[model samples]
Target: MHIGITGASGFLAQQIVRDALAHGHRVIPFSRRKGEPVTGCEPVRTFGPDIDLSGIEAIIHLAGESVLGLWTKQKRERILRSRIDGTRWIVDAIGKAPSRPSVLVSASGAAIYGNRGEETITESSATTSVGFLAEVANVWEAEGQKAEAAGTRYIPVRISLVFGKNGGAIPLIKNIFKSGLGGKLGSGKQWMSWIHLADIAALFLHALETESVHGPVNGASPNPIRNEEFTKVMGEILKRPTLFAAPEFALRLLPANEASLLLDSLRLIPEKAVQTGFSFRFPELRAALSDVLA
Candidate 1:
């Protein structure tokens, strides 16, 4: 398969590109800058509708602004605009392409479910949760859905907290725990859904290859852990004490209440992936953490 990947420089995208190449598939990375190139792949530098995608079999759209910092007004706008505009550009490019890609594996977030305490979220779950992130996700997915109108299979992967070595959230969390300052956020009772970086990257390939999978797929493990349990596991893995806790009020007082990203409970399950016979290599948190830390 010839795959066209946007945001090829991103951590997740780089993994996907590597996996795709390893599986004997051709990868063409699309970047906004001309000089930037992804290793071992031909980089196409363009972002507008006129971008050439003729002969690209599938596209894994992952370009977007990072949402890690304090959610200031400008930061929130950038997050939303990047996804919305980026998806729009890709969809438009698909429409204009002489030969459109068959499948579009776009990136969404599990935050679309919001703070659903104890409720297990699946692809069928209604996205009624209201928040800045939720709104961004809803809009982002909606934009990606436009490709369906152009006779493309649009699969929006609703990603969870990604755990990986050297990238994603794990490295920072590891440092905090190593310093013995890591602890549960708020009451630590909130459910946290996570996926190993390898599993998430593989799931994208699964979606690209599987014909039965469609629409929004939850990119999370079957076993979701509570915040306290996650903290405990981190402490054990890092051999550090988790004796601190950040109260909810204190978190909310932070700029733009970015604490919601930490405190929001999303018990996500990969129902569609499982039903379609996709398997996760690191389904358990402890094992996943061990492999990542090692």
Candidate 2:
């Protein structure tokens, strides 16, 4: 399999490329910026013809700006534009290709379901959250739908908070812990769905090969833990005493009301992943944390 991936420099994207190559698949990295070359593929910009994705077996679209920044109006616009605009370029490229790729494995988010409180969301759940990220995720999923309409097998991977050593939410939380300020937010009982970066990268390979899994798929662990549980386990893993807590008011001082997302809860289950027989490498929070910490 010669996989063509966008955002090859991104944390998740890079992991996908590495896993693809390690599995004996060649990867063609599609990028808008100049990045260190990937081992199995050539790096080409969105407009360049140097790499033709038509020849590749699959396309994993992950190119987008980081969404964790302070949500100023300008920052929010950039977050939405990066995914919506970047996806348009990818769709256009796929349309013009002489031979369309067999599988289009694109990224989506658990955030698409928005803050459902105690509602356990599946792929079919309707998203009614009125926020910038909710809207961006909706548009992001639509971009991949275009490829599906074009007769390509499309898989929209809606990933949850991926916790790993170097990147994603865990490192930031680890840093806060290292700084002696690690604790839970809000009531700490808000449900938080998370996945190990290892499990996330592996899902790309699973979805790439598994014909049973397509359309919108959840990339979270089947076990969804509360924020308090997460804080406790993380504190244990790092051998630090978890003591402090940040209230909702403190977070509300930040931009875009994104603090609500941090403080709110969503209990997401990987129903499709489990039903389709895709087992998680790190199902429990402690095990996942230990593996990443180790």
Tens digits of per-residue lDDT for model 1 on 1-294? 999998877889989999999988899988777666677887666755566787898999999999987778889889999998999988998898888899999999998989899898889988954888888899999999999999999999999999999788988888888888999999999999999999999999999999888899999999999999999998998888999998899988878757789899889999999999999999999999999988
Judged by whole-model lDDT over C-alpha atoms, candidate 1 comes out at 0.90
Best by lDDT: 1
Worst 10 residues of 2 by lDDT: 43-52
Please give the clash total of every predicted structure, in order: 0, 0
How do the residues 145-210 of candidate 2 rate in per-residue lDDT, one tens digit apiece? Answer: 898777788888888899887887777778898777989998898999999998899997888888
Cα error of candidate 1 at position 134, Å: 0.3
How far in Å is the alpha carbon of 50 misplaced in model 1?
3.2
The Cα local distance difference test for each model comes to 0.90, 0.81
